[model samples]
Target: MTKKKKIKISELPNFDIVDYLKTDKDIAQYLTVVLEDGDPALFVAAIGDIARAKGMSEISKKSGVTRESLYRALKVEARPRFETVTKVIHALGMKLSVHA
Candidate 1:
């Protein structure tokens, strides 16, 4: 009989979407996937992911949203105001576009 190998949690490779979203092309691809998911949480989560990718503190500063508020607003359970969302999006150098 052959022996099976076991892998520990610590032995697993770290995977972070933010790390993959370093370029405009990468961010666009990620956003395309998020939009395809058609889940609001995913959109909010995408923003959160981008925020983290660009440094939450810097995003907060650029958005005029406190770090605490940014964290709370992007939470899956939180329904933050549209204006606040816009600010964060703009801070991340992104904007919403409409399609027919």
Candidate 2:
């Protein structure tokens, strides 16, 4: 019989989606998948991830929202206003659209 080696939990590298979101298409697809999941909190976290990837300061500048406010609004379990969500999406250089 062959023996198997065990790996410690700490041995695994941290997986951050923000690190992989390198392009607009990547962000779009990520958000799309999260939206399909239909979990509001998950969607918010996904947006936060993309925001971090793009730079919170830059997003705040483009969205005309304070960086602190962006962080508060995008955090998981945060029930931010629809207007704020739109602002962040626009700031991210994307738009929200409805499909039939």
Candidate 3:
């Protein structure tokens, strides 16, 4: 009988969410789905994902918010101020829109 070989799960290549959010259309569709769900915290968290995908330092520089602050604000359950949220959204090349 031949011996079977097994690989540990951790030994497998890691999956990075940021890699999946590489394009503008991909990010837009992802956020749109998250927005339709209507969870404020989730929306902010998605922003965090986008920030990470685009590069946190760049997002921080563009948003005019420090790296630490950006992480805190985008964290789960964090209630960031409107200005901060807007800055983050714009930093990710996105803007809030309303439809009548």
- The candidate scoring highest on TM-score is 2
Off by over 4 Å in 2: none
Candidate 1 local lDDT, 1-100, one digit each (tens):
9999999999999988888888888888898899899988878878888899889999999999999999999977778898999999999999899999
lDDT of 3 by residue, 22-96 (tens): 799999999999999999998889899999999999999999999999999997799999899899899888888
Off by over 4 Å in 1: 6-10
TM values, all candidates: 0.86, 0.90, 0.83
Error of 2 at 73 (Å): 1.6
Cα lDDT of candidate 2 equals: 0.91
lDDT of each: 0.90, 0.91, 0.91
lDDT of 2 by residue, 1-100 (tens): 9999999999999999999999999999999999999999998888889999999999999989999998998989799988888888888988888999
Error of 2 at 37 (Å): 0.5
Number of colliding residue pairs in each model: 0, 0, 0
Model 3: per-residue Cα lDDT at residue 76: 72
